[model samples]
Target: MSDSQLAKLPTSGMRRWQLTPKIRLTSVQATLADDLELRGEGDAHLSLVIMCEGAGWFRLNRQAIQHYCADSFWLSCASGRCQGYDFFPRHHFYHLLIVDFSPELLTLVEECGLRVPGDEPKVFSAALAEPLKAAMLEIQQGWNEASPLAALHLESLALNALWLALGQLQTQQEARPQPTASRLPSRERKRLIAARDVIRQQASEPLSIEEMARTAGLSLMAFKRGFRAMFGITPWNYVIECRLKLAQNLLEESALPLSDIALRCGFAHASHLTRFFQRQYGQPPGRYRSSCQQVRMAG
Candidate 1:
């Protein structure tokens, strides 16, 4: 893949690289001059698009128009003859990265026991996880490195990202309800989803279980039961997870003091962040930041 091939899109700048025969990476930095609709027709493949900074709408095979924003992503798998329209607003600056996995790579994934979502064409969106976000940023930064080993380095990063993405998809698949099993009522499920979104959007704030339950319009006991049944984790634990994810992103992307990062991510102090950071990621915040810096410098 190359910029010449991507010239059809209304991008101010574009770059594409073939990481391997089975995997290709492309990054686009664009300020659209007008509303644009882009289409695709292709053979079997899986694509993961990471929206680093942008807002757009896309639909596959005339499905619902799905909106994507900065710090989010969408994954699509098509067997053959897939069609989609990607719409970008006029004059909006957006930076996004796309990674395409060829059919051989999908075969390898299945051989490794991680099933692709389904045989039929499908697309889904989700919030990008901290580690995956870190990986994608590294790929973008290292895309033009002059080092002789850059290709190898990028291949490794691309694989790491694909693994993380597939893991998320698998988790989502497992969370879906089975046809024969009992399921949460639609109204209750929507409330629970709203409550979950609240945690994700406001992880830095001091939130209480009671407050979250109220947000879901359910009593505390019922809230806890329904939340756990639907999401497979306690509400409080989910809060912690959200906070930690924010902390991880800050550690990788910013130069803020550990104490400041801790407070920003809802931790009480630097030590509190260090404790949970170590338990979850096997390292302290300072060390993690240093490691990220080293990778950037190496690139």
Candidate 2:
């Protein structure tokens, strides 16, 4: 939002409601009059925002994205050093829910392997699907209800919403076809390192074969062949393996929820993590966590 746009917002009737229900969930529900704007910047917490009612436009850092009601976005604190966003309403009224994940949750998400498919600090969903919408609604209700332990409900709701959003993104990813390997060029170690770094940075986002090849300074075929030959695995498999290892470490070391561990590790949900962990370690992540705890107690 520009300075002129910010000045045009109604001085009155734009109310900001905030609730710190739990250490992990910070909820901000706001209502703004048309042409009004909200601007903020921060690091240290991941944010999940929803334009729950009415249309709005927002810019996160340099990228401008518009949203309608139910449109959702997640912003990671680790990216861009610091993250910023400007929000302005297009309709007569705009309502939004902004949920910030605490540093602990963010760390858990990373450890559990919650990889999103983009380098951009903010990842947007054009519109949330039914599952995500329901979760959002439940959180909203929990936030509105003045009851003891409402924070607990909101915390669960936030995790559920996060999982749904991740699952939706995962579905979209699975629907897209993977790149086929092409003709190979001469192998180089530097290219392999460059490609590996790119994958690590973008593990949370979708894997882009073209981007990897370009970063590695190799042709598509050459990148594929060289990456596989050097790493003993294809680029995609290597990414998954790296994430799974991180998940294993979190499962053993942290008492964070499994769903959180799933997000951190880049898996869509706990079930997805379970399948992969079971395949690799002969037990699910929950079981692994339990076993580790048992061994610790025995020792």
CA lDDT of each candidate?
0.76, 0.60
TM-score of each: 0.54, 0.56
Give the residue spans of candidate 1 off by over 4 A.
1-7, 107-119, 175-299
- Cα lDDT of candidate 1 equals 0.76
Clashes of each: 0, 19
Best by lDDT: 1
Which lDDT tens digits does candidate 2 get at residues 117-230?
A: 234553535466667767766776666566658766666777777666656654563454444334333356766877788777767665656577777778665665577666
Models, CA RMSD each: 16.2, 8.8
Q: Which ten residues in a row have the lowest lDDT in candidate 2?
A: 109-118
After the best TM-score superposition of candidate 1, give how far the Cα of residue 255 lies from its true spot, in angstroms: 59
